[model samples]
Target: MGSEAKGLALSAVDPRAAAAGLTPGLPLAEARGQVPGLVSLQADPAGDRAALTRLASWCGRYSPWTAPDGEHDQEGAAGAMIDASGCAHLFGGEAAMLADLVARLERLGFTARAAMAETPGAAWAVARFATTAATPWRIVPPGALRRALAPLPPAALRIGAAEAETLHRLGLRSIGELETIPTAALAARLGRGVARRLDQALGRLEDPIDPLRHRTPLEVRRGFGEPIGRREDLAAAIESLAAALCRRLEESGEGARRLMLVLHRVDGTLQEVTLGTSRATRDPAHLKRLFAERLDGLDPGFGVEIMTLAARAAESLTARQTGFMRERDRTVDLSGLPELVDRLESRLGAGMVTRPRACESYLPERAVAAAPPFVTAYPAAFAKGPPRPLRLLDRPQPIEATALLPDYPPVQYRWRRLLHRVSKADGPERIAPEWWREIAAGATARDYFRIESEEGRRSWLFRAQGRWYLHGAFA
Candidate 1:
């Protein structure tokens, strides 16, 4: 939402693009080089998926069948597929609900393409792959698959890369060609992927896209003193709330994957914060630390009256076993999260603790987000990824300088009216967004290096366009 875009892919919209000349899979560099003035950003899959999940949850406000689509398979951000059939009248009609959803997303800066159909697979294909000028999103009558997908690309078939490639090599680029090929020969050569894709496209195969909901038990609360304006006051309120909340979770025989704190302000506005743990825990102290790091947003101008805390997305609770020969730890039963959340809210604010969520997008910055206190835990582990700063600049700031090599640290650098000399340095971890990411081609590559100043202080460093900028701090 800043210099870098927020949701959707940067590749989705490039400012330099003329008449939207951009094509899928085109190198971001070449695309940007074509449009020198393109402004772009990295998308956040985490935020996107979280928003989608919330939408699915909010769908209950409309119809129980509403579900989100396209999210991280892990961490409960897996988006969903919904069935909005004869239930259209539930919201006055399908068109009205669709309009309402679009309006809701638009208010949140989301542009969506929605379609309704008899089958989940067909609906999904139409929602994303359908061209506006061709078959718009709608419920086609029975026996309409041939008319719906005959002209579309192979992707609408939901086939894998290898089969799609084979079809492309044979000049069978559209679904129509594959349809014309004998099913027997196609199955003989390309095997099940091609056959299954064809079957899915034609609605002969049943395809199910499940809505992601954490199986964990949950508890929620709506507080009367919503904002709790002062930081300390908010923290105090949170403790008792957390304890009460934990007691609810304990009764269910499951541990929460996340915890959400919703502050329905006196003004009817909603502010949320979330927290997560490395392990399933109701440890109050640990939650306080996590929340303390992020509680600056709760201004508590008037006062918060309604606070709702819900914990969903769960797993069966298990006591931790200590040494190989030892039994489970006895103290593991302590659900300290309430006490910790209490201290943190009082110290930080009413709505401060949060946990990171995984989003399903190819964009870098859009891959993770601080979920509201609802999601109770973080990824057990992340794959090898770009080096992240212990402290990251709220936004990337351009620097003034030249670089023979984006390494060896600059001899001198200036920031916020201070100048410093470099003394030591470590590597250049190159991070690049996907080709289809909606980011500027010129800024696609970031070389993050660890640098030490003459004062013997280590800092996170990065160079863009041969200019050096200090990005973060390191202990």
Candidate 2:
């Protein structure tokens, strides 16, 4: 038996329990007396709330705006709300979308009933009470909200239970009956709730829904009369969406960094494909290339009926000069390098392509680090520093060396079991140990040199603590 502080009561019940005359909050002892061999389990309100949040997120395929309905504490949630205003046309129509939403939830082992109206209050009321064979899921058409809500009880107007009972005793059984009474008379008795709820449901007052996710501003969607299943047709749809998105970006002077594609299948499933660019781009051709790498992975199960393209992240893009001078046009521009890097990263994972960035550290390995390729901003270190080696060692290798003087360049050195006699050498360039490092107390300053061996092979070597180390090789 499920136990609580109130003493062995049912916290929740299923259809079978309800059919057997067992209801929630019923004493377990009485439940067992009424129906022999009754069983119960502990309730998990927190887990239920968490599941509701996830379900709200998954509802984004229908609308970007979805919020959990009803106030919740430790008791769990009531339900969820989806704002399918502009989204319904994509799934065929308002009635079709409502039916599809309920059917899909039922397939996922959930009992769901959905209603769409111009007002949230009317939708909520119609969803709970309005039952008709012609419309499986309720949909109150515009200008017909009052007629649709006339049959529902005053309790369906979201009034308090006690208030509903009081109104019922006063013979105000239906919303239409309540509407006939004057506002002042109803407020004198029912305390303004009846009038407020009636006004909210009949579109006399505004009702706003707070969404769980942020809605992207740059989104374009297209719906088809018939479902499309061909790969070439999907490609054409994507290309068309990219072009439309570029036009929108151009009007706003913004470019996309990350983009997402949502394909709504006829079978009520959603297939998503996402791609990112190395640089903010408004070029439709470039955007197509990035999405092309992952387009093959999409499965248009039962055909796709609607497709949406959205820019998830964007940045300001300034206009660039397209027409080049005759003489200057001969010089090749490296501005297109970012596109190349984006293509490589898209084809072979983002980690595969990286750039070397200079860090604020004295140690050779710590001084330079590998980072993602930069497109918009370039580091100041590359512009002001002296020339570095073409290739640097992961860590400096120790070597045996002899120098002409104590603090001078190395005259000769042996590295990796090979001896090299220095024919020419440059003066020592000193680098101090970083004061913040833990090893700074015992660390000595490094004196670096550019040395050319007898074979004219140039190398960068540094000396610290009376030991020589090969740091890099010059090309």
TM-scores for every candidate against the unseen true structure: 0.41, 0.70
Residue pairs in clash, model 2: none
| Model 1 Cα lDDT, one tens digit per residue, 179-264 | 88888999898887778767865778886656444322354443342346677877766766667666776776666556777664
TM-score of 2: 0.70
> At residue 461, what lDDT does model 2 achieve?
93
Query: What is the C-alpha local distance difference test score of each model?
Result: 0.59, 0.79
